[model samples]
Each structure stands twice: as structure tokens, then as C-alpha cells.
Target: MDNNGPAYHEMMELHEILNFKTLCLVKSKMMSGLVFDQDLKALMEKDVKQTTAAIQDLQSVYKPNGGIVH
Candidate 1:
């Protein structure tokens, strides 16, 4: 980390990005239930799993400790 870490604007931007991703994850999960195609449902399941893991990683980055994985 540098002497100057992420600025307020950067943090705010990260927050917004995570918010959007979370929304997308939820919507995709909901749509997965409504979709009838087997392949599409599997894809949606994969998407949900990957997005959830990614979100956890991003949250670690947003943590005060600067991305300590646990």
C-alpha cells in the first residue's frame, strides 16, 4: 500500500460497483428459477456461485485491512 491509499471517491465508486454486482447476482438467481432450459439453468447456477465468491473477495479488498483473505 502507498502512503496515500484509496481516496474517498474511489471507495465510493467501489461501493457502487459492488452494489450493482449484488443486484445482478440476485436478479440472475431469480431468473434462474423461472428459466425452463436445462443448460441456461446450469449457467445461472454457475454465475451465482462465481459472483458470490467474487463478491466475498471484493469485500475483503474493501475491508480496512486491505484485502486479507480468510
Candidate 2:
């Protein structure tokens, strides 16, 4: 088997989980109300932003020559 396989799978799984969490957060915000309280909305937005950044970072790391994976 290829040496990169396990790392690739783990990264993919992490990406999937992040996507799921983003979806859940969005749904919760919608269900809360059209106006969802400022504090909660802020928190959700922060989480989403951070998760998005993390996914982007992972993608960058996985890019050819990025050197994240052995």
C-alpha cells in the first residue's frame, strides 16, 4: 500500500467532520430564529470561520511539495 494512504484518509475524514459541523451550526442558527441572538450568532460565525481556515490550511499542507505528509 502507498505510504501516504493513511494520512490522506485521516485528512479526508477530518474534512468531512468539519463540513458536518459547519452544516449543523448553520442549521442551528436557522432553527434558532431568523434573528438568532447576537452572541450566539457571533459564536457560531467564529467557529465556522475557524473551521474554514483549518480546512484551507489542511488543503495547503496537502498540496504537492507542501511537505505536510511524509
Which candidate comes out best when scored by TM-score?
A: 1
**TM-score between candidate 1 and the true structure:** 0.81
User: For residues 1-70, could you state the per-residue lDDT of candidate 1 as single tens digits?
Assistant: 3645676667777778889889989999999999999999999999999999988877877754443335
- Top-lDDT candidate index: 1
Which sections of candidate 2 miss by over 4 Å?
1-35, 63-70
- Model 2 clashing residue pairs (backbone): none
Per-prediction TM-score to the true structure, in the order listed: 0.81, 0.46
Tens-digit lDDT track of model 2 for 1-70: 5564446666677567657766765775565466458887777667667766765666655544323554
Question: What is the RMSD of candidate 2?
Answer: 4.8
Clashing residue pairs for model 1: none
* Every candidate's lDDT: 0.81, 0.62
Clash totals, every prediction: 0, 0
